[model samples]
Target: MKFTKPFLVLATMLLISSCNSIPKNQEKVISLKNAYQKDFYIGSALDTNQIKEKDAGVSSLIAKEFNSITAENCMKSMFIHPEKDKFDFKMTDNFVAFGEKHKMFIHGHTLLWHSQLAPWIAQIKDSAAMTNAMTNHISTIVGKYKGRINSWDVVNEALNEDGTLRKTVFLDTYGKEYLTLAFKLAAKADPKTDLYYNDYNLCQPTKRKGAVALVKNLQKNGAKIDGVGEQGHWNLTSPSLDEIEKTILDFSALGLKVSFTELDISVLPNPWDVVGADVNQKSEASEKMNPYPNGLPDAVQIQLAARYEAIFKLFTKHQDKIDRVTLWGVNDGQSWLNDWPIKGRTNYPLLFNREFKPKSAYNSVMSLKETKK
Candidate 1:
């Protein structure tokens, strides 16, 4: 009974199911035409199989609402290189095509990360070869997507939990020069691209200090750093609202564009249960995943809505400093929350409910216009 209208897909699916008029389920999809004004990229962590020309699952939601897209996996090093000495654009090209077809702003996810890199990239321990290879890779990817991507998360998760250099191979081989060179190379390759530094725990003072210092060093070195992407992968109660607002202010104070690159709030049974002894030590991917309870009763769904209201209220309070807000996944079924942090927790922390229906949280975000009322 929410204020939504039946989308074409739902109508079609219903017609096929019963050969009649639209089902009542899609009545809440009110025409969001011009619902958003700012050119911010409201996107998800993964694009799903939409690139494969399928219109089901996460793709449907993104197609319905978003005007921008970020490849959660396509731009990563591992997907680009499952084997060394052979780079494949097979999957990446599909993502690029999807972006253009939808006219969605294409955001290249990452240029460097300690994790998710190919084993071969890790083998380049020497400075000369490492630097050359890095340069080549950056040029190829950025150049390939020149004038294509809306922006790029030029670097991802470069700092540790405590804000220290993560001892990544790029760090060992090239040091701070690696950071500068990567940004510079990306700029030279794609002069129109927006380059950024992406990281997590950025709200923590320790990590915040490290990130600020890194950006400061890069600015001093004449690097053309365009933005800083705060990976908004946060929990329910941690990273206080004050800290989140202050973090944006501090980063924006540096005169760099700021955005939330991969954001998701997990409503776990216990937010602190994934630490130390409670952590899942499983090695196999299957052992690490289990079905989320999906048993969040109706009342709890509205509770989720209030939490979203508070967060969006914060966003409205500081809209000037924020460039974009991206949810990590489109909906519950595809969210990394099911297996992330603890590997098995039924977390309902997004706008869309399990039935692909908008929750009260959805109305809260939709009504997040100016927030003064």
Candidate 2:
């Protein structure tokens, strides 16, 4: 109480120094991975550059904030086995090492898809040769990552909008048996890894029915099936909250784990008359379609954040049945939405922005975990 002015200033300086000396770990804020550690994993897909550890910030952010890693494209058929005889494991090996180094759960994107097929497989007319090629391709790839991969999207985008099998080269050659064959082959290669049937727009009635039938048929045929991946490539307005929840519940009813394999919300206008979530669909870029050329407006950003909050809330409500939810890309700039459907358009579909900083959507989603007990 009777201290001199110099002594009072010295005491204040000491207090300030003590406050600033807090340990880095204590000063660190909770990251997405830390926040959702108990509920479920929070993951983002890694493009080529990320897998190679070329971008220091992205690599560091991934190791710091995520518990899972998915190779963006290296595992695809075209990239893995570009020809009938050759098999390339260069980038794929890099991806596996990257994931293993980070101790992240590795999810193999796809084993079978009509698109991204090697030209030789697509050109094959003989059914027997086609079947042999398919078997060899699946066995080799799955065997390479046998115990390493936690899950595999064994088959992708196989159902048409009307609930019938889309006629691809696989189906044309092997009929409905092709689906079963793919699952069986993957299972044989890695009995431990979870085999999944992944597709987009499972929220639609027809696609949902088709998927249910496919899983049931696989079970009946004694094929080792593990899960279904509903690619959450959704929009803000379309695919109502009810429909999305219905899809998750319906898929889980099969006693199989469900995953949001490729989740992204495109904050851009779509071309007229597009009904289903077909990744192959494309339209000419125009002023009307690419409305937010410069950046997302404040109003639109709020809408995007609210949409993400609602989706995450639904996920939290059904965390038991859902195994994992992975964002399609790390940031808006790396999103595939910018190219597909339209060539050179800006789309803010991810939780992070171009600068590798969290957006409003990230905050909204993370707030769920914070407010939880």
Candidate 3:
């Protein structure tokens, strides 16, 4: 039978309505790793709960968004090698397995750090004893995960603000040669793994110069150093983009890859005198410091989104010179800032909220390449 105009119009209308009724969940979910896969690896530091997959939501979110992983604390000296004669790999083994299961790039946090030393290590006073301890620590840990770990932060926060080496137990016992010694030991353990010198406040000219000289010294001594990690634990306004760009240029000039490790933009009031990520620093919590105890205000949320957008734009601009960008933690609830500088205070710092949902900042970062296209 020949269809009439009214019948044909009704059928067409029903088809259009059916198409519009498609479920919202059917749309593609954007993965952070896929967005910048060509530029650099997208990573996050995993805490103990995440490593064990205790919370299915947390584990699923990590596998979906990130292409790389770092242990937030398990691999550190105090935890891994709690005793000079004993080494624990229970949690560390699980962390590495999680990364390998997802086929993600695994990075070991640090080999030799001034802070987080085992009690026995700190008590040692003799030079020979310290040398033997350092050698045992580096060789044991690095050799354990040789090929499984892609890179290691061989030396972390070794320099002070004045462009001078901080007088840690390692430095006091071994002198300036300790930096060279650590890298050399790491290279001997894992000849193929990349070794890095990581530090905070590296954007400052003096500290940046100190890092440059440190890397140069290691080079002069024929140590294997492949990259530098500028721990980007920045706040809402400081460390101007110009300073960040200059840092990228300066570090890249040394012929080493630059990584923005442990990045998070804290939306909290910081004490005026506090600087760098010194774990020892502490301040009493008060109402003024914990202004947004309930939740972040709409206006402040918008500002946080803008801040993240500006930072990611810079990263994309210099993707060639950069190697990786790893957020400090998976979500705000797990952020170290909550207890750091001030205890029992709320802080919103990561791209995801406490509920594991992507916030405005996540959208701003994910939409970057789209706008460019």
Candidate 4:
């Protein structure tokens, strides 16, 4: 009650110091002046929230990475067939137009996918009707955007965990031959668009082996397939450097361009304390029982950044083998990390910080020694 003026000033200074010590939202505030930017392409998904004509973040990313945009879910069958007899071209058109205006390359997410297909596609008993419907859909939608989309996920997620053909409307009706037909159909629709088979966990040996065989088989048949999309949804550790390098080499030997598509490495708190969780999960985990904390400790965050550096380093070494590098989502806010593997848990596996600013991964990527020589 009787404090002197000096004591009050000291108290105020201490309070201010503590407040400044707290970590603020630094992720979103990126400087447009980062000089070490790479010429390698950078892109994120375009959604309802991000479709605005004047998005500074999007614009900056476009300015920095040159708008190599990826269509997220719109080109999929689900959005196309929300109702029959009527196809929605709103988002697809917007995506293509955005890329055109920005003079950036656009990727057509998919011509065929098992998870996001329409319900009615499976009911057709007549094989011809089914084939016609598929052909019509691809020829219409993809063909409509023909000269626009530079690359296409001609088929997405068609393989099961064991690399066997997944049972979906496409396989059941068109049989295993549908994949080949789909690629050929896509090629015919747009002879110039690069056709790709895109999927996740491609770095794993078991899955990579299957994909290699599949791509080689497609090549033998003279399918105009152009590339492989390795969805890099990696964990903190799981896939070792050996696995990823071998994977890149294995796919490259197929004479198909390789793209590290949909890449995002999660660096969130490890839930090792949970019951029935594997103790020795990934090579990077420090402990099996409780791998993650509320905020990732500084030590682990450094490892996370190093991991990003290592991946990019590998990418640089194999730059000749890669065609494009696309992240899964635009930012952490839109990432699938929220509901995947462990639903409802906070995950931090992206280049942008939670605040949308670039993280250490950004610096590491920019600092990577280009191996293009």
Best by lDDT: 3
Give the alpha-carbon lDDT of every model. 0.73, 0.88, 0.92, 0.72
Clashing pairs in 2: none
Using TM-score as the measure, the top candidate is: 3
Q: Which candidate, 1 or 2, would have the higher lDDT against the true structure?
A: 2
lDDT (tens digit, per residue) of candidate 2 on 77-146: 8989999989999999998898899898899988888887878888877679877998899999999888
Score residue 179 of candidate 3 by CA lDDT.
89
Q: What is the TM-score of each candidate against the true structure?
A: 0.83, 0.92, 0.93, 0.80
Candidate 1 per-residue C-alpha lDDT over 1-373 given as tens digits, one digit per residue, 9 for 90 to 100: 4544567678778778785555555334342223444535566655546566576665656777776677777777877865656678887898888778877777888888777787889888789988888887889888987898878888877777667777889999888678889888998999888889988778888889899999998899988888898777665566688888878888999998878877777665433334211123332334224334746667666666776777767876676777777776667766766666556566777777667677777887776652322
The C-alpha local distance difference test score for the whole of candidate 4 amounts to 0.72
How many pairs of residues collide in model 4? 8
Residue pairs in steric clash, candidate 4?
Answer: 27-356, 27-357, 28-355, 28-356, 28-357, 269-292, 270-292, 272-289
Off by more than 4 A, model 4: 1-39, 53-58, 268-295, 369-373
Candidates, ranked, TM-score: 3, 2, 1, 4
Model 2 compared with the native: what TM-score? 0.92
lDDT of 1: 0.73
* Residue 150, candidate 3: alpha-carbon lDDT: 98
Q: Return whichever of 1 and 3 wins on lDDT.
A: 3
Better of 2 and 4 by lDDT: 2
